[model samples]
Target: MRLTPDNDLTARAFARLDARLTRETERPVALALSGGGDSIALLRLATDWARARGRRVLALTIDHRLNVESGGWTAFAGEAARAAGANWRGLIWDGDKPQTGLTAAARAARHELIADAAREAGARVVLFAHTADDIAEADLMRAQGSTLGRVREWSPSPAWPQGRGLMLLRPLLGERRGVLRNWLAGQGADWIEDPANADPRFGRSRARQALAGAAPQAMDDARAQVGGRPTMDGEAMARVARDIGARTLAAALVCVGGGVTPPRGARLQGLTARLKAGEDFAATLCGARVEAASDGVRIMREAGELGRSGVVPLVLAPGVEAVWDGRFAFRAEQAGWSVVAARGRLASLSDADRAWINRLPAATRGAWPVLVRDAGLAPVLASEGIERRALVVERLRLALDETTHEDDLISATR
Candidate 1:
């Protein structure tokens, strides 16, 4: 294998990325910068490239609020972006932090916040600075029984609007971390190291430590062996190629079911087998209930799991949009409304609505949030907002499915 000189890696990485950007007509692209070496390099390279092309790039730093230095880091990132002649914004993950699964929660929150910002800015794509070394680390982690999948060059933003159309592009996934840092050093640029990176408590930290002595594996193009994304066909599960189909289905279930992680391998395989057998069955896996009917199989959040998941009821104070159950994205008109499961109200709908409600599996009924105002049920579903929400949800599932091929490619290289 030939080596790319440290100085040329950045340009080479961008050259690879430029081909992917040909169809991007969005005025400004969003970059998620962490003030770390990889992201800083990306910010610099992207800024220069965007400027030459007369395109705008927005560099966003997320302050996860997990450490005291987070604010300082974000501020520094903002300054770096501005100095590089790019627009900058600092997003904060402000909310009640989860006591358990903090990393996963933080990741979800981070993407949601970033996607929201990108959408607000009219940008359809967000860039991340993950590198080849990160993929190696993830590979090591997976070998050690981690289910975390390969990082793809491009994916649908796991969050709302992006699930609709916003894309997450990782331009540096083919470049090595050391090469990026070397380039940064050559430019006399400095970066901040998060203490958590060396804390050893995190799996990532352990993987990083392991990489020090691990034999280097051939780093093939991270963007190879594309597979199909997940999708439901009418009432039946869509037929996808075996290997990719399972992965796409798993991703779709996890994304739609609001699970922090994908379903276990054995269970996923079993579900796929059942789907392929064309047998009638119903089972709950990874917070989602898969029901195989004569017409088709429907994958939805299990009603019982919703309450257990501790998804608090959201009150929309007019013109505000919120994601519920991590599955449904909703926006409501001005004030006096609370969104919760249809529950008992399923019986109160008009005959037509009743028929529609009855079509939903029993276990999935409570998974749908209905609007309530003025001591009565509000016409949320009647307003066709439910259809729009469903469209977004389906789009997100397709996005995950479309990216599953990339995941397959990454896995093959590993």
Candidate 2:
């Protein structure tokens, strides 16, 4: 491909993407195309790269259905993806929308929808078009007391089990928004400008306005020092240093608690302090129970929170897959399958299964999902035609592992 000044952006971005696709190069790559300048530019670049490599590109657009024009935007995204020679999938955020915290909720919904769509399409890496301008805006928001964390060049998808094995790549994070828009214009392409981006009511809009006419600042490459094991055993984390322990505990709580957001600020510090001081106590944070005992600290999902959160038994049909309670990814290969908590049914379990369940912490055993066929219960670990996989534990480990760098391939936790 010829590299004009405008087209050079595509070359550079493609190189970044190429570096990240060291593994899974044969798999179809997916991108989140929002009909915006950056994403449209990404679509073209990704399609070109995929085409040259004889790989396929899956472009996913999420319709949050928040604005009247969202349907039009999704259509635009689909058309853009098809024009770029990529397969397009439109996902809808159906049902009732939250009255408050709409932005956060919409973002969460977008991630979940995109992750599900990408996974369903057999793609493990999802490309995002976040640029330097986004990092600057995020920094401005954080300076103005927003709790947004720093955006990295590569990171795990934020959505739980649905995003279990997925990695998000921001190949254009080093590029500027204006440069990408110029490149798109050079190609005679157009994109939708969401009115919400300029609405002052949103923090991002206010930040964008505040940074108007200013050059985008370069972002630092600092990684979180958080570290943790892939299991729920508390003893493994007992002797960790204070600051590291606090960070690890936060990640552990979020993972084991099955919550997307990690606990922060004073409460987390207090809990870390107590644990560091060797205090034996039990507490709950982010829907996960944390117990610091003489045996060590054990963290598990708080079963009551599951009920309060309205999580129920998951029913799966043959050849269907679903995530249960944000923890396990369950796939049914047989006709009859349902996953329910193992709490009251422990006595009915086979002696061998019961023994295995007994080995786990008492608090965790009740919340463990057990497979059911008709009226009889089957051991999740030993069941036939039912593929049960724990998602959060290994994912959390990868997210918190210091050895896992941005360049490392985030293989599927399953």
Candidate 3:
């Protein structure tokens, strides 16, 4: 048997990922489709690559209900995928409402939906169509204060799953945006232009139109950093989330074991602002239940709510998929929530607590994550009579346990 250097390297990468995913799923590959020039080019490349290898491909597109041109893109993407001759599916989802700007929330919804869809289809590899130009522009956006940069996160395309431990791959991480567009044009591929992409009124729209194509100088700078920023903005944004009082919008309950998550309201508006401003940020966290104001770069928490005259009480039940605050149908999960609920304690304790608290940069220490919980504050575990959640889970769990015991005793007496 003769194996060359190239063969060995390729075999090693595929083998590592394949082994990791073997227990979870069996499908070969999945492509995230957007019906746009960049994504279409990626789809074509991946399909050709899969065909050459005699592998199956799964194509998935998330239709974010934000743009008026949304439905058109879904159909257009489906047809294009058909032309590419790959098994494809389109997921239509209600996008997150913006706390301040619409663009940031919508993109978060899109990526999350894509992740879930890929998992459901049992696809081993979830390929994203982000290009090198996207990476350069992302660096520029990160430098110039675009919040979407935080969510999309300047990582190279196909960021490997770090949170859920999913296997994600980005094949064209170093390919330039222009290269993809040129290739698509040559292939006579027609893609849709989301009208919203050009609207400067939206922060991301401005970044896409102005900075989507990076200059040579910026590209050089990003390369200087060596493969873009490795960190996603989820943790950073979560840190800067302002303390919206309980009356207006209940603080999002930490989902440690598995319970009910709370309402986010618009206090997250501040977190979005933090993403845009880079190091030091200033912005107001305005929602239906928050009233915070910032001074250009410094955030100050306060009290207030949007539409206060007749506030609609946001009442979400366990397991119900609904948009609370500006996010999507993100409820809580027992496994992940238990880990997330331990976020606050990471700071308070010493050595042992350090392991429990997910480590983030010092700059992002304060941002509390908006976790999804299953029931109403379930207990994952107890330690030294403490509930173990930032918001007291022991009290609730013990009370419930006591009530159950009493009921059982009464039944026995009867």
Candidate 4:
């Protein structure tokens, strides 16, 4: 079946995108446009949706600086967004580029840049143009021994600080790549195919090559789950008989774990099985410790991991906010302050500061970020803001419900 813009398929895609928007948000919505078929199609559809609702859309294109052609590609993306009647800007990932883990670093940088731009533009929600093909590729990667799990339709910004108070929406997961391209074709629009997509060096390209002839299916479990805290009820989880429910629980553990990535599927499965067995025990997986609480399983960041791992300290400018250790994002009142994880430095806590730090979960207390200036501890930041706050506290506050663990799973997976 051939798909075209204004056809039934496109209409359905538009409906799916519109349904996810609910009401106009308090702030503007932003779209990450890559000048690719999927994102350009999204730009066209989103601009119309925004226009009908009288809401503004900010189209942000990130130039990763990974390639010489990246600049030209971003300029094309900007033009596409403007043609679709949306405000557009290009963000460049400047500064040190790592030699190893370039792909992983670039992906993180892309999310960070887009999310930061969205925040700066006063947009609380940012939409991505990941299609069903992308989801299928993620599934393929998982099947090929990749540690990554299924990509959810809606999720929080995977990057900190920029991710704070921001929601990432993927509305095109229901649409196939061919269908989206068909829409762009009908509109006489074109897109650039990044060379990295076909390069054998990337796992994603290999996955795409493996599935070159396979048909990507529509995701059935596309319903949005309300965000909740990271904790889950042992009794409640024991009642979960469905495989999807268990996977959802696993995703929650990974989210709250504060790991750079979610744990492997087998590990998640084992954890789920242990939870369903109803045994009270404590275990660590993916940077989070899961222990049986009076009510259920309380999973929080593994404080021990913070001490072993060397985290990159962030330079905080005056009035600039950033996230540290996936737990907390804070702003400095003055410049020349550096935010670092407390870790072994907890011994430096004063009497007043220790009082507040004592209130946090023991396993995750050491993961908090503290400000330092001129080799002296910044006591005001530690006692007043940093100590009283948990890493996921801002995320929890932004969630639809402040209470409930299972209901607050941070994933947007169907």
Best by lDDT: 2
In model 1, the worst 10-residue window by lDDT is 405-414
**Backbone clash numbers for all candidates listed:** 9, 1, 21, 5
Give the best candidate by TM-score.
2
How many Å off is the CA of 350 in candidate 3?
Answer: 25
Which lDDT tens digits does candidate 3 get at residues 1-414?
Answer: 111222232343344334322322236577789888778877777676666556667888887776677788888888888889888889887634767755545655666677667656755356777655566556557777653322121221122121122334555555555666666676677876666667777655666677544453323422222211111123112222333223212222221111222333355444534444443433333321121235222221111222222223233343433332222123332232322222333344445435433453332232222332343443232223111122112212221222221112111000
Candidate 3, poorest ten consecutive residues by summed lDDT? 405-414
Q: Compute the lDDT of residue 340 as modeled in candidate 2.
A: 84
How well does candidate 3 score on lDDT at residue 40? 87
lDDT of 2 by residue, 252-273 (tens): 7787777788888899999988
What Cα-based lDDT does every candidate model obtain?
0.70, 0.77, 0.44, 0.68
Error of 3 at 377 (Å): 17
Please give, for residues 1-414, the per-residue lDDT of candidate 4 as tens digits: 455454765566567656556445555789999998889888988888887776888999989988999999998998888888999999989999998888878889998898778888877678898878898898888877876645666666777645666777787787778877877787789899999899999999999888875788667553344222343322111112222344345545545655555555577778777776776778888777777644666766677876676677777766655656665556666666777766776777677777767676777777666667755754333523322234444453333234222123242211
- Quote the RMSD, in angstroms, for model 4: 5.8
TM-scores for the candidates: 0.80, 0.86, 0.48, 0.77
- Model 2 residue runs over 4 Å out of place are 1-8, 22-26, 222-224, 227-246, 307-310, 376-381, 401-414
- Give the worst 10-residue stretch by lDDT in candidate 4: 233-242
- Please give the lDDT score for candidate 1: 0.70
